[model samples]
Target: MSDWAYSDVVPWWPYVFILLGGWLPTDVWRYIGVVSASRIDETGEAATIARTIATSLVAAVIAQLVFYPSGALADIPTWVRVVALCIGFAAYQLSRRKILAGIFAAEIVIGIWALAPGLG
Candidate 1:
């Protein structure tokens, strides 16, 4: 981790730079999303695609963190994650599509599930 390490040097065939190159692609998409979002509406095709991407990304992250999870999430049962998602979905519906309610309800489900006799 020392600053004087030779690996920090900007060599021509630099692997260090390549390793850090991933940030550009991610940032490009973020900037594109921001710019394009301004031109789209709640029901436009762009919005639809954006929503689809957002939903897919969220689902993928949750699924990965549930099924192939590490850290604290690895301790919970699969049923708990599924139940939490369902509760969030139900909240999404009940709240008249309010996203915040869905998020809060999912957290509530996690808390309740954690407090349950088996999950703790």
Candidate 2:
């Protein structure tokens, strides 16, 4: 086993391991993206495809979190979650597709539901 695996002997080793294992790999891709970003045409077919795929992945994750949630989210009622999602989508559309508006609207619904007596 690595020294990082045994925290008692080397507490700082875990941070080093995280830097090497996690940050370095992701940072390399980010650097590459930044370097190549200027060369990529935003309205090009490749960019459109990439955006579509990214959006699909986000939608899939959101669906998973709403429909098959774990922990605290799972504890909340499914109907409430669905309603929040709908409201959030509506808010996003109404706010000219502002991401933060959608998120805040959803969060507000969840918060109100949590605070309201016997609704959770």
Candidate 3:
């Protein structure tokens, strides 16, 4: 156990345990949400609140990426990130609020910016 702990690489067992530890709580909540939502009308207050909370969480994550990124994202210029986000939001609005389209647009724009001569 000491040797495993000292090594740079984590053993397979720890990864398995880590995966389960990370996934179980989220999966349990997801299961509960699915079961609970089955009985809730889509037009009900509860459903609206759930949707609002989910949207707020996504927005918070996007805001965090823009304001407090780590690793490679931290290295990107703020203007580039803001531009990418604006393009993404525009794409989302133009694409009838398709989230994937928006995300892809942002990623593509940033990727092109990074690949541009003298950038990144």
Best by TM-score: 2
Clashes of each: 0, 0, 0
Assess each prediction's global lDDT (C-alpha) against the native.
Answer: 0.82, 0.95, 0.89
Residue pairs clashing in model 2 are none
Residue 69 displacement in candidate 2 (angstroms): 0.5
Residue 116 lDDT, candidate 3, scale 0-100: 93
Error of 3 at 90 (Å): 0.7
| Pairs clashing within candidate 3 | none
Number of the top-ranking candidate, with lDDT as the measure: 2
Estimate the TM-score of every prediction. 0.57, 0.84, 0.72
C-alpha RMSD in Å of predicted model 1 compared with the true structure? 5.6
Error of 1 at 2 (Å): 12
How far residue 56's Cα lies from its native spot in candidate 1, in Å, is 2.4
Off by over 4 Å in 2: 1-11, 118-120
Name the candidate, 1 or 3, with the larger TM-score value: 3
Q: Give the runs in model 1 whose Cα sits over 4 Å from its true position.
A: 1-51
TM-score of model 2 vs. true structure = 0.84
Where model 3 places Cα greater than 4 Å from the true spot, the runs are 1-24
Superposition error at 31 for model 2 (Å): 1.1
